[model samples]
Structures are given as C-alpha cells and as structure tokens.
Target: MSQRKMLQLSAGVLLFLLPWFGGLVSGELSYNFSQCLDFFYKETPPKGFHAAGYQSICQRYKNQYRFASLYHRQHRAPLYSAYRLSPTDGKRPRTSWMYEPQLVFSHASPEMEPFHIPVDQNVIDSQAVLLDYKNSNYTKGHLNPSMHQGTEEDREATFTLTNIIPQRAGSNSGPWNRLENEVLRKFKAFCNGSMYVITGAMPYTSGARWINNRVSVPEYIWSAYCCPSYSTSLPKSVKSFFPSYAAVGRNDRDSGEEIVPVNVRMKASMRGYDVRRMSVETLEGILKQRLAVTISLFQGECQ
Candidate 1:
C-alpha cells in the first residue's frame, strides 16, 4: 500500500480498537469515555456536544519542546480532524487561550452515534466571522485554540466550523476557562503517552441557535483527560496545573434558571501545597497516576 493508504488503514484500525481495547487502560474514566468518545452511539440533543475523533492540532508542538497542560488527538477524526479556532475580532490575530476553550464539540451521548464533524480548515479560515451582536444572542466560541496551531496545516485544521459553540463571555473566560487550562496543565504533568481531551458545551435552553455554519453553543462543558501509565514521578511544573479549586460563575438572569449562580461563594482546600512551585515533571507524574481531588461549597437552601 502507498504511504497515505497505510496511514489511513492504521487510523481505521485504531478507531475500531478504541471501544474494545484502548481506553480505560490509559487511566481515563470509562464513563467519561462513553460520554465523550463513543462514536457508534448517537447522543440525543438537550445534553451537549460530543467529540468524533482526535485532531492533530498539538502534534507538531510536542516535537519542539515539552509543554504541559496541552492535549492532542489519540485517534484521528473519522475522515478529518477539526481545529477549534476563536473568532478574530475578539482577541487579535483573533485568539485567546488565557481562559476560553480553544475549541468545543458535541458531548457524546449514551443513545446516539458520536458526532464526528471534521473541522473544515479551508472554510474556517475562509469564512468565519466574529459578528457584533446585541445582548441575549450567543457568541461564537471555540473549543480548540488558534494559538496552539502554528502552521498553515494547523491553522487550517482549527478553522472547522464544527468545533464552534456559543458561550457566555464571563463564564467562558472565567471559571470555565480556568478549568480547561487546568486540565491541559494537568495532562502536561502526568501523561507520557498520547492523550485525548474532548470538550463541549451543555446548553440550558433551546432556540439559542448557532450560525449557518452548524456551530452550536454549549450549556455545561465537560472534558476527559486520558493519562498513560508512567514509571517516574511528575515534574514540579506539572503540578501547577493541578492545583485545587476551579471557580466557574453564572450571571443573574430574569428568565434563565440559575443553574450556576453568580459569585455565591464556593471554595476548595489545596492541602497547603504551593501550586506555582511545582515542577513540570511532578505534574506529568500526577497525571500518569490520575491523581485529582475536589471538594465543593454549596449555597444554603439552594443546595
């Protein structure tokens, strides 16, 4: 077989083996795998977006230097992978990894075939528009980030419209953003083998339609990190991303149900470990071990 054909065949085999043989061994939650990557099952609407396959967006960066908290595709998207780029006007060059999701996807559901929509790099770079909208309308948001994409191939891949989602600016750029980056940082500390991270939004209400590009906004965002078994301890820097207590907020609205209330005072304990001092090696080790702990503070009566 030609080189391209062999590559294709290998990808096909990998995808086929995912459900039966590959996942949990990597230390990811099987439940999360089913919810995020199960392609054969079709998820129903009203839940969230689901991922189809791995995109090669971060593949190139790894070769340059080991960067923690970054994620890449474990398996190729069915036919093509998507990029997950942000709108240009929002941040210049049109990017922001500071807190927002670099890209977003359909949350794989228990009942439906996994939606593996390939990001159309050509179309994304060619047609994406950051529209000026009045309040109440959702804004285009990305799950994958353009900063992570360095080459034409990388940039183009991110342009796929499928990775787009509508998101609230405060939440998207605030706690939600913090969680996404923290996950990326955690993976950088612990995973030595290839890891997969698929994120999507869960919407609260209906009719908050996406643009003509088929891009949709998310309601609740979910992600899964697959860590490989490793022999050594993680570096200190790696531990930085894993620091406890991620805060996400919801603005007060008249009609919307306050699923996530505004600044209601929530906190978690850090066990007195200084997050900034941890090394990258330590972080990677933690991820390899799948070590993460959480505690929540609930509002009274509303709990």
Candidate 2:
C-alpha cells in the first residue's frame, strides 16, 4: 500500500482505540504507538525508565558532553528498542534502528567520555518494518556502537535500527570509528557500572535544513560521555585509547566519494565543558540537578 494509505489506515485504527483505551494515557494504546512508530519498540519497556527518577535524571543531568547531535525519541516500551538520535531532518525521514546503538564520543574536538546507548531488538529481527540503514545511501552510523556498550547484551543491543543515522561512509569509518573504540577501552579500565551515555549529531545551522539545503558539509562531529563512577585509575594504555578530540583530514574531499561528504577542516571550534570525574554518588547528585534543570527547561510539570 501507499504511504498515505498506510498512515490513514493506522490512524483510523488508532482513532477507534483511543477513547476505549482512555486516550494516550492507557498502557495498551501507548504500546501500539511504541510498536508502530517508536524507534525503540521492544517486547517490553526498558527497566531503566522505571528505575527511580530515570526520567527526572535524564532531564536534570544537563550534559556538558553529548555522544551525538541527534536524539529523536525514547522507546515507549522496554522490550521494544532503545532511543534514537538522527542527524538529518525531513518529512521523508530516514531513521536508524534502536538495535544498532553505537558508543560515540561527542565533541571529538575536545574529546571527553564515551556514552553507551542501546537499541531495540525488534528493530533487528522484524523485517516487516523499514530500517534507515537498509536502503538509504547513508552508512549505518551508530550512536552507541557495539564495541563500546561493554557486555555482550549491550553489544547486541547496538544492532537495533533506531540507533542508526545517515552518515558519510568515510567519516563513519575513519576518525569517528576510532574515537568510539577508544572510549570502550577506557571503560574496561576505569568504569564501575552503568555509565550513562548520550550521543547525537549537530547541524552547523540548526532547524530543518537538509543535506541539499546547504553547500557546506559538516565541518565537525561532536561527541562526549562521562564516566560517572570508576573502579580504578585508568592505565596509560587506557588513556592511549583516547583519540585526539579533533581529526585533521578524516574526510578527504579529493576522493569524490558517492556518499555524503563531511568537510575537512584544519581547525574546529572546541567549545565545551569538562567531562567532570566524580564518585557515583556525586555523579548521581549532578545528574539530579541537571535533570531538574532540563525538566524546567522543557516545561515538564513533574518534579
């Protein structure tokens, strides 16, 4: 069926169920949205969401570092998939899977910590849905690559469709790829448990501008994640894993590659705050403060 027809049919089906399920508030109705549209549509909602103050924590933990520039929406169910971040914006959208989460270091220019965001399982096993990585000319750019999520479970979660985005193949594979690997090495040495990660892409000019809109390419990719708690001091080998926050020529414009082109800038803005190292308790406190701040910023009434 056509896109319009599918949308209309889905809408009609949803409309009929809305009132009976007590509008969007009902769990069943919410589940439908999660299964149909959410990037992270798992078999169940994430346990993280129910974790005490998770929503609040995410809202208040104002991050100085972000793993990527695009964060779309959280999965409605835990069993569905992980949240997704996308660099591109269009009505004709190409979204990544929740299953393919990649650990990305935002703000590579000032390089910081690595964040791990998992994707949904449904995004992988279910071939019924269209995945952003399947047909688009873009690479399967992971927000939290498997190499960094740590555990095998975490690594597997990276395959979900929601964690992907349209990325220039060269940028995705070269410097950007190295940065992610380096972060994983750090975690193995110093991290304790549950290191929160946030990643996304940043548009040089914000709003809904497409790749076709601007003649300029992405001058830089920003990534940062904090190791809230560490079990021990990281060794020199661990530190060695960290790449220079900036890459001079990861994108070679001379190649005239078929994929989207990322610009090669000798220098980039290294504007960002420090990736503060602290005890888990202290990190929790900081996260609470930031989450509160974010909630207030977003007009969230729940405190």
Candidate 3:
C-alpha cells in the first residue's frame, strides 16, 4: 500500500487499548536501563540526576536494543542519550520520525513507532509530537546522530523523538556537527576496541526557551566518550583525548561564554555557535556548576 493510503486507514484500526501496569503511579515513569546496558561505559549510565520528571528509556528498534535515553516528561525533551560509537556504513535512512509509546502507555510496544494522523492525545500530552515542530524555528536535533552508528538498523534507531531535542540550525549543522566528525576521526585512528559515548542537552539557568511551547530548547550541547582500550602508540598532540574527552557547543548566540564562547568574526551561518573542546574532568566541573549537581559522566573519570 502507498504511504498516503496507509495513513488514510480508519482510526479504529490504529487505535489501541493499552493495559495499565499495576503499581505505576501518575507523573511517574522509571524503568531500569537493563535492556540497553551495553551502550554505556562499563555497562554503567551517567550518574547524578535521576529525580522526578525524568524517565529512563532503552531505545529498542526491530526487537533489539540500540541505545538509551533519559527523557524529561515535563520538558518533552531528552536529557541525554547513551550509545556505543559505530562507524558509518551507508546513506542516511529516510525513515519517518518516531515517538516513545512507553512514555504514555506502560504496556505499549517497546519499539518506537511513526506518528499517524489524529495523533493520540495522550501521546501528545505525554511527549513531543510532529506538530510541535511543524513550521517551527528550531530543528529536531538528534542527541544520538545517525552518522555515529555503523549498521542500518542502528542508524534508523536514532530517529526517535526521545533521542532528540530542539536545536538551532547553526549549532546543529556547523560547530557541533564538526565536533562529531572530529570524534569519529579520533575513534578510527586511536581506538583499538570499544568507544562508549554519552551526549546530552544542558538547559539555560534562567529564561529557558521552548519550541511551540512544547519542547524545551537546550542552551548548550555537551558530549563525552570513554574508550578505555586504545592503541598505546599515539601522537603527543592527540594523547590527551585518550580514554575520555569532552566538548560543549553553544546552542544560542547570546548565551554566556562561561560554558562556550561565541565567535563573532565567523560567517553569519556559523558565528556565535562555537564549540569548546576540553578534558572530561573540565566538562564535569562545568556540568556540576551549571546543573548544581555532582555528576560523573564516566566511571572513575574513565581511569
């Protein structure tokens, strides 16, 4: 059947009656990241901020665990996504965007499903929907980008809205995108084994921005990796990046320079959205100060 025809199907055929899981309360969604533990370093997730309004999701696609995301129920955005870095294999998948049904219905399908017309009201109220981004200034930025994954299925799995946030075009395609490529280069050159990565969004301290009054726009885009196993034969310049290194990019032009500075001299499209590269420890310090929480992104700082 054609795409248009499939979407034209009666709502009766699509609407589902989900079973309520007992013992689960309202404004509460917490599941152990048990299913997707392999994506994290040492099979351990980022520590420090697991309070109310935050839910854990094991991003399952095609009945296989791909990555994990810490989604914020109130913000309708993800706090971060943890995944194992994979080499790119083919063209980007033109798959339709998806949402996490488990956020709305406890016993719904574990996999991410594409949005259909007349979207379920509960799903929209629970999480971000396609309409939230329609004609909006912000872009549906993936915390776990497709280029970072190796297999086709792995790439497709990154399209879920649970793994995305509202990002500006300058930061998403410019400096931040460059930072991702840089990490890929370092991974292909120095890493001998696995490389685990955790990428997250850092919200503003005050005057938080929202898209369509639905999704929260992040102030800074931060990412870190832990590749404990690597080739000992490394260059002096690139030695500091081993095991663990981190970076934070400016998502707003007028944001403070404390976390990331704005480059006023660059072209209009790329200026003001600069990316600051630093050691994992430095990144953690900034995270602590800004978030007002003592958080560790890697195990023992990837020692």
How do the predictions measure up, each by TM-score?
0.38, 0.38, 0.89
How does model 1 score by TM-score? 0.38
lDDT of 2 at 233: 52
Return the candidate ranking by lDDT, descending: 3, 2, 1
Tell me, by TM-score, which candidate is best.
3
lDDT score for residue 155 of model 1 = 42
Question: In the order shown, what is each candidate's alpha-carbon RMSD?
Answer: 14.9, 16.9, 10.1
Query: Candidate 2, which segments miss by more than 4 Å at Cα?
Result: 1-137, 150-153, 206-220, 231-303
**lDDT (tens digit, per residue) of candidate 1 on 61-123:** 212211111122221011112222121222224322121022223221111112234533532
Off by over 4 Å in 3: 1-31
Residue pairs whose backbone atoms clash in candidate 3: none
Q: After superposition, how far is residue 256 of candidate 3 from its true place, in Å?
A: 1.7
Error of 3 at 121 (Å): 1.4
Candidate maximizing lDDT: 3
Q: Give me candidate 2's TM-score against the actual structure.
A: 0.38
For residues 126-168, write the lDDT of model 3, one tens digit per residue.
Answer: 8899898888888888899999999999999999999999888
lDDT of 3: 0.80
Summarize candidate 2's per-residue lDDT along 188-229 as a digit string, tens digits.
Answer: 556564333344332222322223221112222334344434
Candidate 1 residue 123 Cα shift, in angstroms, is 9.8
